[model samples]
Target: MPSPAFTDIQLPAPVLKGRGAIGASDNRYELLSRVALDDGWSQEEQPPPRTEVSFDTSKSIIVQQTALDLPFRQSLNIYRGCEHGCAYCFARPTHAYWGLAPGLDFETKLIAKPDAPRLLTEALRKKSYKVAPLAIGTNTDPYQPIERSLGLMRQVLEVLRDFQHPVGITTKAALITRDLDILAPMAAQNLVRVAISVTTLDRDLARLLEPRAPTPARRIEAIRQLSDAGVPVAVFASPMIPGLNDHELEAILEAAAQAGARTASAILIRLPMEVAPLMEAWLREHRPQRAERVLSLIRQCREGQLYKAKPGERFRGTGPVADMIGQRLRLARTRYGLAAPAWELDCTRFAPPPTLGDQFTLFS
Candidate 1:
């Protein structure tokens, strides 16, 4: 009898550190796959354990902006990387600049902007500063799970309220509902609006795709609560994947409408740089069976490429599948009475608080 052949055992992927980890200023980002060596066989491997959280404070709190196409001319990010860990997140590539993987590391390694409120206040006091609807969560989410304890978002909102600044917030965290006290009064002045990103209503799919986010039902409930509080709330069926969650477009809109969302928006999936491989790995891990089909459909929508970065076509892709999604989204919007009305935040109400110097001048 032939000697029993032993299969090579594979080692798990090693956790990266320093330049290898995300947000590392170093140029080298690395990954090591483990494999077992066996005669006439390859090593077997196991998935690495989940990444852990680490943080650093940013020097400046308010990030200035000159971009024109985006809705907000200026924005703030309370945190870098997000704990919510939505696999299809477009912001993931930003981690590469920090030398981190857009994969697990992007979600696990987070940085908080504790001084955001003060920075915003100072920025607003500048003579060159013009009042516009400042957007929060423009890059990474401001209300990610960590915010509950950090209270950074709450503090930023308090600053916005104090200055009577016009603002817009986009988030998936249901915790935004906790600030109903501030949001409601701001809404009364048309100074604030909220957009909730709802990708799917299927609980299991959402669990696998979003992982750490609030459940789909809870997101809808948050929409309802925001609307009930008279806050102008919208549901964004954003980052719609071609073969994955795209089919739920109409259902998501209808559900959101029922939950009292007056506006609906969508963005085609974006797989910029490292986000492609990360998302592909996610699909293989959590959606292995449908992974191939899903990837193929994405390529079809992206004009045979993994992504299209063209300014006009970036948010909405091209091709037959993209056309279908557009039609479905338009129909849903019309059928559910959702409208793309302007948020039109009030800049007129913006009034800087009295500075000590200003008070002295006034008294003198």
Candidate 2:
């Protein structure tokens, strides 16, 4: 069997983590797979539970010049390689750029920007800095489990609060609830909005889909908590996998609405590079019967391919199947009374920390 093939499935329990886990990184242009010939392996051979893995990040926390399509032109990532282990994350391929496998390594071998708040403060203090609502948790989650100790996200929020910077955040972790004190005050000034990404309502399915994320019930509760605190909250029913969790779209939206989510959004599944093989392996293991059907539907939108990376076409696929998903999402949002919130965050309230130029003027 070809090493790069998505059909090269392997069980992900102890074998995949230890012996069978050896594989090529994405740089090799081959999605490697391992086979274990051990006999008497039971279905109970559950994968060893994941543990914390940490790495260091450089001083630059803010990524400037984001994609034009994004609502915010700048982004701040507190961490790289999310601990959530979401199977369908397009961000997986990014880990490969660090010479790491986008599979288990991307989830377990996490990285943190301890200097994020300091760097953000310095950046905000720059004379030429312009204020736009900075997007948080865009490329990777800021509220992953390790954040409990690191507190990098909280630190960044503190800087934002001090400077009155408008910011947007998205996370699947219920940890966001812990910061309501800061967020509520920021919300009062129209400086913050948050979107909680709830992938599936089924507890078992959520476990398989986003292994480390907070449960669906907890995410709903987070929405209610954030809304109750006077913070504007939105729900993201994202990466609607075809023939898979797509059926849960309306349910997730309705649940979020009932829980006080003011707006809702979703994206079609996007499997790129090593992510394609990784997601396929999980599908085969967990949803064998519908695996091929789901892949077929994905290809239907991707011009008979697993994925197309074009900016416009990547988020939502093109063909009839993709079209139907988009239309269904619109109808569901309307039916649930969800739309972009009426109020706006004020950029004019921005007060960048005093810069060197200000000091020079003071002296002159």
Candidate 3:
């Protein structure tokens, strides 16, 4: 046997329809690099990759967080990669852990946790398990397109409902409205809150940034529906890209408030790891005129770099641009009645679900 020869392959990078990334880039841990190059041969363009779903057999579903700056102490992600395909997703680098590219592969190749409900039930039943607000859609959107057919998120919600556990969900999908049967009741008990992220009000721009997510109008409609159903809804105008969508901040908050968002929040764009390159490529392809200005403004906030990992500065960034963005958000929040504190999901009402054997005790 001979050792295999490893060579980098330069393939074509095309702007596929309904996809956020220009092409798939090799993961950071790969021993070989893959790049796109034109071979000068005339050939028909290949169709874009179709989304593929795979299963994860992990034993646990709940993840404990030690990050003090995060709003939640615990979280669960039902999917590994997001189909929403937002170009600036902060979680893109996580796909590299599975030896997958953080670019197109992150959106096309998806992983589902089929056993999440079962594992969550077991964890919640443990005596050592302390009741806290469990966050869903923290890393990946739990209600991505695949969720419509998989129903994994709905099943997990069932488990949470059975235990009367508190939960917070953040998503850019309107598919969540499909679970109003579960959410409305939970909201009545002060056990659930939903935050919908609307990145841009311009339909065309939103299509480019988050190709697969629901339209901004649909998200506002989702907020209205949730609020009409009595579920407390919050609006997230997140990852505000300076010199680009930042101007829409006030408009977004005002729209959400008109639609019934009780609270609002925002995060400056974060370009960590492979995301920076992907975003730069996307900008060059889509907004070539303003690409340089956008990147320069981002550097202004990140202290002359694409990104800085400082604890307090990561979310809001620094410098005058970031400060002004924050100031504008505060003003919008106050003006639109979105300055209220986040809803306090009731954790004191958590009750352990009765086991099969315990059900038999009723007859005894």
Candidate 4:
């Protein structure tokens, strides 16, 4: 039988307990180092260090179609591997496809699309490009910490604004507030909407779960600022961890509603692929005492499994706990009059960016 430490071995990425890469065809390595103990010995290994980066070249800016039944159809990810480094991020497993670990690598290795604006403009100029709401920061946050230095997301938004195209954004960064000049006008025409994801209101838990992201208070302020500026602001209490953060659901919704959010939504925690191990490790390291209970509750919702990929049940598991959370969300939303978005963004007015060649053709 596998050891107790190996109970949850089905991780998305292989966790190398020692400092060496595992080869598919080789197994001649010696046993990893271990320490003696009174009853049994203990083993310790150092996790890999973080990696820094400059930019990531993206051939295409638009990620065309996704199978998920989300509201938006088309999406754009300005970056990969969020620097916000939320321990429970569902997007972490995506890094493994790039030959990187979903643990520190997902948080450290940065990817930016410097050509995002140019590519977006080019795509919009296409005759076949249908005009629907383009979503930003759907996969990874466009306004992650790197935005402060790179300013890539701002450029993409500028392109969208110039084209008069409809866009939707979801982010936890306060940086979006800096673009009020553009957002306020788009919002006036009902051309844009934004959702701020706030996981918990506890500053300490926020730090441990989402270390680099803005504080809960700052996210609330973001909603307030956007709403006051005529922008439709919504709150997303995402990935409602069962034992870890379920208790904060009502409190989070109340705080966001007070901050001017007119709509609210929630998603149960999803552990796809390698995110399970990465998150389990985080729980063991940060909240050791409650780790078992947390895992148990998560499995209870996931049908006795740590995760379930069923299309209908993935986003919000079906169980008594998940049902209770959904009920509470509905009650909170009703109480605050946040059942629907303050306004709907207009897509009928979407106009493609004009090209120099098109300008001459127009005059001809």
Which scores higher on lDDT, 1 or 2? Answer: 2
Q: Which candidate ranks first by TM-score, i.e. highest? A: 3
TM-score of 1: 0.86
Worst 10 residues of 1 by lDDT: 18-27
For candidate 4, give the lDDT of residue 86.
83
How well does each candidate superpose onto the true structure, as a TM-score?
Answer: 0.86, 0.87, 0.95, 0.85
**Residue 57 displacement in candidate 1 (angstroms):** 4.3
Candidate 3 local lDDT, 249-359, one digit each (tens): 999999999999999999999999999999999999999999999999999999999888788889999999999999999999999999999878899999986676674
Candidate 3 segments exceeding 4 Å error: 1-12, 359-364
lDDT of each: 0.80, 0.82, 0.94, 0.80
Best by lDDT: 3
Question: Residue 168 in candidate 4 has what lDDT?
Answer: 92
lDDT (Cα, tens digit) per residue for candidate 1, span 122-158? 8888898888888887788888888888898999898
Using alpha carbons, what is the TM-score of model 4? 0.85
Q: What is the C-alpha lDDT profile of model 2 across 131-191, one tens digit per residue? A: 8889999888999899998898998999999999999999999999999999999999999
CA shift of 244, model 4, Å: 1.0
Candidate 1 residue spans exceeding 4 A from truth: 1-57, 66-68, 356-364
